[model samples]
Target: MTYWAAIARKSFQGGSTVEVPLPSSPKLIGASLLPPKHDPFYSQLFELEIQRHTTIAKRFDFHGSMIDQLMALVSSKSNVKNPTRVEVVTALLNRCIVNAAKKNNDPLRPFILFMPFTIQNLLNPLLPHKLVENYLTFFLVPIPDEGDLEIPTLVSNIQKEKINYFRKYKGININQTISTISNDTEDFKQNNLANTRLTTSLCGYQFYDMDFGFGKPEKVSIGAMLIKYSMVLFDSPCKGGIDVVITLEEEVMPNFEIDEELNTFTSLDPSY
Candidate 1:
């Protein structure tokens, strides 16, 4: 998988085959002769079943007009300058999810967002070849108690957390930072219980442009392997818009879907 991924990355960057290093040993592993002990159909069947039993995923669309309104709101109301679409959307989702938990008679706990950051741009002069492994780091944004805070305020707070983390780890070695964050993340999870949520943005990744010899994909989905209390944001087919796939406890989904503030800007289960 890593070998193929490396090749794909090189191809995406218009690099030649010579740029990628060959594997040291060439060994072929054949399929097992015996029947599988468990379900052998879907690789993630167990994981998906667990997710299905514990959570539900809801898809929502935020149109261009909605995004514009959010941008304007962030600009006029918050101290965060030029807030990106991802930031605003994340803030809104976080707020709505927390509100849903509150309405569901669940305790309002602080949120810890696991946001992914690419390190390719941060490298000096850049690497001669892309690394096969993930060149990504997670930004842990510890959200304060939502209370009655508005979207703009939440956006500003999220940005502040990101900026602080970046500045603190700016000159540190990437490997060291990753190790430290791993320890910190484990501690946070142990201490926070059901408070932490993972939020990832694949918006600007141009996933729609990929061609697997079947032409461009009409739509892309993350499928059923989702973490509970997590949200994944993607760029909508239409420009200046976003598609959010959020997973929450099945019981809390109803309240989240009908959230007045969220409904003001999002179209639930929207068809293209």
Candidate 2:
């Protein structure tokens, strides 16, 4: 990667430009139609519910500092300074999960979560290229069967469980793992693939300084048709703000949009 960056620098010094082909290391994997064999009833049940549900898309702009503030509060309350972004995000997700559970008529059911994990070299100072790889990973977060617990405890528990799972299975072949998890067999008996409900992605990436010969773009965004019950987090064009693009069931979307806690940080019609 550094060698390529040096080559690019040399090319620019010679007053010439080069356009290389896109990297092919990461390939796209389409959605799988495999069933959860152990819990075929639940699989069929969610599928039927999905068909009857209507999808809706909405973009929300919220104060960026809200997360920082939440982090500060968490730190002060727990006497643990320097909380990571993931902690704050987990808190936010917990809020959403609780809200969704309240709106959901079913309590004993679990939800499917599909989040894209990006492996990028940008953060590695030794690597000087913008190449990145992405994998759609699945996680099952358990909601209460009856009422709820405290938000901080819920978030901390989920994060700890996830960290432990990754520590136990880190560096294994992701493709093989995904294949085994997706297959309808006994291999996934101990896994959590059978009960996933909500999907979320953190897309608020910043490449504002990326340039060739021209200046930076005024804005950047991902324009894709998302599936229902999914949420995407994006960096707003302006500073001190974040954008949440959510796809939910049509009936539930309006209720979600009017959520009091969510509305606290949201801007009024801050459309892009």
Candidate 3:
């Protein structure tokens, strides 16, 4: 294993970044997925340790100065698997809880949650009740009023987990009130999936256009880039809502990084 691969495989619990060599082969015989994500096993135990120590790291508050640099160095650039803090946390919660559900085969278990803007406020009145379970609760990265958050491990973890688990499991009984994207109606045929209530709340205007302070944008749009190379999104509220979280790498946020070389490759369409 190369140095980067070895570093990525090692648990990254605390740092902002870790340099990792790209993996030579697709298969990681024994490497970890990625680090700085709340390791489910580690988190469950650490929650107790922090409580025991009674020093500083409080529940849901681990980013303080109390954690050492070595602990923080876990977030690495591992394209071989999940490579960001957000990706790792989402994967852990998704895997451990979904694995538990699949083990028991629950009839109404939800592996991937869809908190679409069309259905954000539609969670059941008892929805608060579901969050108490380890599998159910998901953290929401608080975007500033302008719409962007810094740390991303918690929500990113859920997205990775949902995508992987549902992609593998063929079908799931989801109670949803979808306002759009109606292509997959077959999954809930005869079932009351449609009856599952959903609601949404929209806020703010698409202000990325008027760049009052940031200066004229070389490019701008609704922001969707899924290619292998660099991924650029200038918009706010990236994935589901208005919050976009990516690694602190130029490969992920090109404009934010501002490299003159890659600037030549940019193509712009205002209508987009």
Candidate 4:
């Protein structure tokens, strides 16, 4: 057998894989025949239509020293200990977004932040090496509606939620959760998934190391922000720094841009 084929076989035999059932219908059904439902996933599509017209994108650069200072501050707090760079940054951005929403007089609703965690390492025993495909699991973090919480508290809350999720899903429980969520349409429909924010970090992906025959890129960016209420984090060209891209309603962008707390750590990237 080919070397690649042998490796694939071994991975499947490792017993970490979960079988996903096929969809109930192979053919597309007419919308007219379908019952109208208020699934958040489908509702977001309609919201996106309005968002595309009224949302704007902004990019901010956080210097390495500033990041260090923020991390130090977070560490000093008694509530949360040894907060990672990602957690600190996520907390800060989430707080800023919530504040901006309040400034815009947006309606009060529970906020859910969806963060993706890599599961490739978790399956290391099953696969000898990283596969050239997306292997991820998502955990949702609930953000407080009141944005007045201190940075340390925010970080602590996030850390606690993550810990609880991990403890509840130790080992193959995560695979089962993913399988059920993916296969059960009724469960998804019943859950309220609105007011959700998406976050992704491209750090440690080594984008700066790639060469396209013209030498390595000086900077990397996620060109356009198509999703509202989403944040993308990238490793800055300089080491130990991060570039954040945020999308919000145009009305809220002005207040968010000039947020006192946010401005203390980040500077607007004029090049963006």
Model 3: ten consecutive residues of lowest lDDT: 55-64
Please, what are the lDDT tens digits per residue for candidate 4 over residues 21-96? 2223222232322223355765664576455557788899988888898889988874676887777888888788
Off by over 4 Å in 2: 1-50, 77-83, 93-132, 146-149, 173-195, 210-214, 224-226, 238-241, 268-272
Root-mean-square deviation of each candidate, in angstroms?
Answer: 8.5, 7.4, 23.9, 10.8
- lDDT, model 2: 0.51
TM-score of each: 0.74, 0.61, 0.20, 0.74
Model 4 ranges with Cα > 4 A deviation: 1-53, 167-170, 173-191
lDDT of each: 0.69, 0.51, 0.28, 0.68
lDDT of 1 at 87: 90
Question: Deviation in angstroms for 43 in model 2?
Answer: 12
The model with the greater lDDT, 2 or 4, is 4
Model 1, span 165-231: residue lDDT tens: 6675566554455565556555554545345577888888777766533456788776533567778
Q: Who wins the TM-score comparison?
A: 4
Sorted by TM-score (best first), the order is 4, 1, 2, 3
lDDT of 2 by residue, 44-82 (tens): 546664676677677766666876676677677664456
Provide the clashing-pair count of each candidate structure: 0, 4, 14, 0
In model 2, pairs of residues that clash are: 111-196, 111-197, 112-196, 112-197
lDDT computed for candidate 3: 0.28
Instruction: In model 3, state the lDDT of residue 240.
Output: 20
